[model samples]
Target: MLFGAESNLDLALALYDLGGVQFGDFDLGPTAGRSPIYLNPRVLISDPAVLRRIALLIHHEIQADQARRRPRLASFAAVAGVPMGGLHLATAYALVSDTPLLYVRPDSQQPSIEGRIIPGQTVLVIDDLMTGGTSLLRTAKALEESGLVVRDFIVLIDREQGGTERLHEHGYHVMPILRLRTMLTYYHECGLLDTARYRTVMDYLERTSPRRWSGSP
Candidate 1:
């Protein structure tokens, strides 16, 4: 794996220092009212060095997954990035992996097959973060309608907010590089997160999680 346990722990701490993960009251969405911890991957785009590192990490992980035959990553013929947030990440991955890149439209605004994807191509869909898998499902549907096969989905962070389960139910294998619960635990252990903030964020995640899913050990 590109980011082993120790390396991932360091990455989580680095992201915290980068102001990507913040503690405070913030809006999650219409359904999820308010949140104590907010995660934003867009900040990484501002720093080319960090963004390239992230892209390389993702590339290495994908290569490792392919080597291990984990969820059959080797079958992927192209990388499809869910629009708005995932485009840059996918671009970087393509640059590193020398894979074809496809940008899935956010909605049905464009022709289904207009992007860089070819019909009958197997694609691995990627996104920045997954909260409920709603956007990803939409993107996958569009890809399928365009005659592309999508079986695997990837995200930079999984909030453990039921998105993975939801995607699995739809027959899509989901891979998350970092999980919110794990990151929070690491932050707390390293003293990067205070006790009160840690408890509050943990409570909020537990309360808001659709299935109250805890990440893997």
Candidate 2:
């Protein structure tokens, strides 16, 4: 158990049991999906060890980031987590990074006056997974409207579904603790998992993702 979480291998299994991450495809309805698995780590908030480990890992990464000083990690004015799913991550950031945390709401409150951008000093929106950039884009737009420039985003896993592409389109970068493909291969190599489930999930995500949308603007 890494910090009391189910063994990291087991954690992936538990995540798999919880229906994998659905990494990218959510709209295709089985017609033309690319991924066959999905992991909603947000669902794992209930497990104390998992939650604690996530927080600790964030701490470790931050320290490591500081150690590898090309630009030298700078203290964030604040940590902004994308709402709902990102809330827990924001709290962990607040505690570990000691940075104040705020989350952005997906919808604008009133257009001209209210949306208010979850008020923070400097934000790093957080989320558990990134499949389509839909949610992240929305969060960025809201924060931007509120005068906060969302520079970097942090996520537990990147389905690699174009979330990074979408964010780039909107001017934000993503940092994920685990990339789906790499993690899956790791588990498979360790014998923690076989390929059957991997194919199911990956295929499903690829097919149904926003990439299929035409004239979507």
Candidate 3:
């Protein structure tokens, strides 16, 4: 029911600006050649209060999801993050919920010998963005190989590029705090964003969206 509420969207947009998360003008090619509206949530670490606020946002979203998803992740065994990018956000969320923290490292080794490096509990994967969900999927695999279940993925943004859909299609539920469409629309409505700049991103995302909707890499 909270999916498209105006206040949640307003708060999300406010966080996007107040957190000072930079959005890139150039595409970063998770699409191989397309990229637009890059967001860096790492900036929140510089401000402890903002970091906590971000945590609160995540906590609220998780609470809502727990009450909603069947099999109920309310007592989720642990919180796990995809390496390098998702570590801090995962830590922040874990700190807020008083939940245990786990991490999925890049398995740069031969297949069978890659144990103890990935996650090992029913983990909730956190990341700032879900571009193609490459890292998320790999992390989930690593978790499973280590006898874990990754039932849910949470992200700060879901670029409207089917990242969210793909994750759900792959049998993992996705909870995104915000999507690019409403985000861009909110900023444009508030005059926080230039029309031309916003248009460029909207057009780019449209053109670069994957033709096949499968959640594969």
List the candidates' TM-scores in order: 0.89, 0.72, 0.78
Q: What does candidate 1's lDDT look like per residue over 59-93, in tens digits?
A: 77777777783445547888888877888888888
Please give the CA lDDT of all the candidate structures.
Answer: 0.81, 0.64, 0.70
lDDT of 2 by residue, 1-217 (tens): 2432234445565566556544444443332244345466777777766677677776666666657856233446767666677778778767866776666544646423222244444566778777776777777676677777677777877777667777777667777777777677766777656678667655555454556543243
Give the top-scoring candidate (TM-score).
1
Per-prediction RMSD in angstroms?
2.9, 5.7, 4.8
Poorest 10 consecutive residues by lDDT, candidate 2 = 111-120
* Model 1 misplaced stretches (Cα beyond 4 Å): 69-74, 107-114, 212-217
Worst 10 residues of 1 by lDDT: 105-114
**Candidate 3, residues 117-205: lDDT per residue as tens digits?**
33445778888777678778888777777777788888877777767666767988777777777788888888877898789877877
